[model samples]
Target: MVEITNMCRTTGCAIGDIKLYCAGFTSANLINPLIFRHLPTPNHDYCIVNNGNPLSAGAVLSFHYDNTFMYRDFSVSTVTCIS
Candidate 1:
């Protein structure tokens, strides 16, 4: 199977526009779509993701995870094969 790398590339994205992105894993044939909204914020310190009340410019973006689904899996293991 072919491996996919460097996805969700944005092109000509203007400000104040909502964008959708899809992510996939190399070990499985699954794709997860995520939504991103660009709002007027001071910095990347605090921001809201998923579906929530849109905050105005200069307003603090609280971390509200009521309407979002974040999937992640990471682990480390050691294996040895006898020759």
Candidate 2:
């Protein structure tokens, strides 16, 4: 298990990004999210399970999720960025 933290960048802004890799494997699973406004402040919950194998060193992973919780037009969630 690994935890990553970073600041917001205009060039590549990923509020929440997640990536999973299998140890001793060459391929990886990528999970990129669409950030939505008016969703919920600290309202989203994400969990990943690795059934094949545990992750090892030098494994690459990437993911992005929305953090905004409110919007003026709609009460539903909306994605601000996707990459």
Candidate 3:
């Protein structure tokens, strides 16, 4: 994680295409979200998990199945770029 507490910028990447990287800022897996949205706050951080574990919060994640996109809650969670 890059600790993207302030360096969140949604640019260059295309819609449905996630640009967040992992530990080494490795190549980001291109996720085509059927529907996406922020978690109330504004940031470019996101998480895409196909496993059963639900994402904590603080990101723009679309579960594809739920068709729901969640962002950081601020009060409870920070910017978790990946799950």
Each candidate's TM vs. the true structure?
0.18, 0.22, 0.16
For each candidate, what is the lDDT?
A: 0.25, 0.28, 0.30
Best by TM-score: 2
Give me the runs in candidate 1 sitting further than 4 Å from their true place: 1-52, 62-83
User: lDDT tens digits, residues 1-83, model 2?
Assistant: 22333233443443232322222211133333231111122532222222222223333333333334321221212213333
Q: Give the TM-score comparing model 1 with the true structure, all chains together.
A: 0.18
Query: Which residue pairs show backbone clashes in model 3?
Result: 39-71, 58-72, 59-71, 59-72
Residue by residue across 1-83, what tens digits does model 1's lDDT show? Answer: 21212222343321222212223212222322222232234532221232332323333322222213442421112112211
Query: For candidate 3, lDDT tens digit of each residue in 1-83?
Result: 12322233454322222323222111234333332222222343433232222233333443322213332332312223432
Give the range where candidate 1 is weakest over 10 consecutive residues by summed lDDT: 74-83
Winning model by lDDT: 3
Q: List the residue pairs that clash in candidate 1.
A: none
